[model samples]
Target: MVETGTGTLPTYTETLPRIPESARTARRLVDLALTVWDMNEVRDAAEMVVSELLANAVHHARCESVRLTVTRLSDSRVQVSVVDRSRAHPRRRAAGSMEESGRGLGIVNALAHGRWGVDSLAWGKRVWADLEVTSGE
Candidate 1:
């Protein structure tokens, strides 16, 4: 069963491994989307953010685990965060020539309903985004 805080559901308090090819992949994220709250649009956005963040973590930092957090915030929005032991923070670069990447954060920022960022504390950094939940519940 998922836990809740007042109106928030699930809270996204999961710590999965950060292996390159861990089974806790897209399907697992989608499963969480369905089980966490209830909104098709929100699910898709959250799943995309999670997948991108997870992929970035593995591809760039080579992390072996991430802390996933999903919390329903005020003003009808869902905040998604994936914390990893990144060597450093994410860098925002323009679309370079023949570049096949460097647009994940921009996508997250565009889709989310509110402010989002990738920051680190004493331990490491966390990549998070927020979106308006349209579950209609």
Candidate 2:
């Protein structure tokens, strides 16, 4: 089940199929949440990070289910996380030009602004990125 905070800040989460479509679904969810929170300023970066995270989960996690979560930590900060039923940790690879893959983590790192990480869970692992929301957002 998904969890949402009742006081001050709110969190939204959902479990999705570990299929290719989930990546798109993740973007839609992030867009909707940012819209509702009046955080559209960070929408582009958030969506890009979410796409990379979800794509990584679907392609590398080797699990049947994935959980996507968006948390509003404060008025100026938000976090997006993906949990997969795989224990394997992901590493960033050095990809050359014309390489179609192996740059998911790199993208996240570049866009997350030094605020992304992986946490080992009892059943699997959760990868998350923290983005700074603009005040006027």
Candidate 3:
């Protein structure tokens, strides 16, 4: 496979607040992956992370609305980025007694094979990270 950096091209987008509606956007990321990742495992990983991040934003970030984007990068890596009109960063809490939530980023960090972080953007803030993917085509 040839390694080419084509900047950042979003594969999908969604609103975190509206989980179901936002899910439709996540499907587009799968379509983008078809051209790169032919395997279901690799593509699903990216899509799942995209959903988790966006959902997290809606659950945590106090934003009117959130935007989710996924971009394919070089070195067989794909970035799942979420932007929200929020100042609070992504946080992980220790799982307490029958806690129903938490562990989103941790799951993402564990599944992904690269770096992830939260940063301040011009408008609000963007939580983005890279997931190293395998290509067999």
Candidate that would win on lDDT = 2
Instruction: Indicate whether candidate 1 or candidate 3 has the larger lDDT.
Output: 1
lDDT of candidate 2?
Answer: 0.87
Q: What value of lDDT does candidate 3 attain over all alpha carbons?
A: 0.66
lDDT of 3 by residue, 23-125 (tens): 5566565446545544344566667777677777767666567776666665477677789877777786676668887877777777675478888977678
The C-alpha TM-scores of every prediction are 0.76, 0.91, 0.73
Clashing pairs in 2: none
Using TM-score as the measure, the top candidate is 2
> Backbone collision count in every prediction?
3, 0, 0
Off by over 4 Å in 3: 1-20, 30-41, 135-137
Ranking by lDDT: 2, 1, 3
Q: Candidate 2 has what TM-score?
A: 0.91
lDDT of each: 0.68, 0.87, 0.66
Clashing pairs in 3: none
- List per-candidate RMSD values in Å: 3.5, 2.1, 5.0
Candidate 1 vs 3: which has more TM-score: 1
Q: What local lDDT score does residue 94 receive in model 3, on the 0 to 100 scale?
A: 74
Error of 3 at 137 (Å): 13
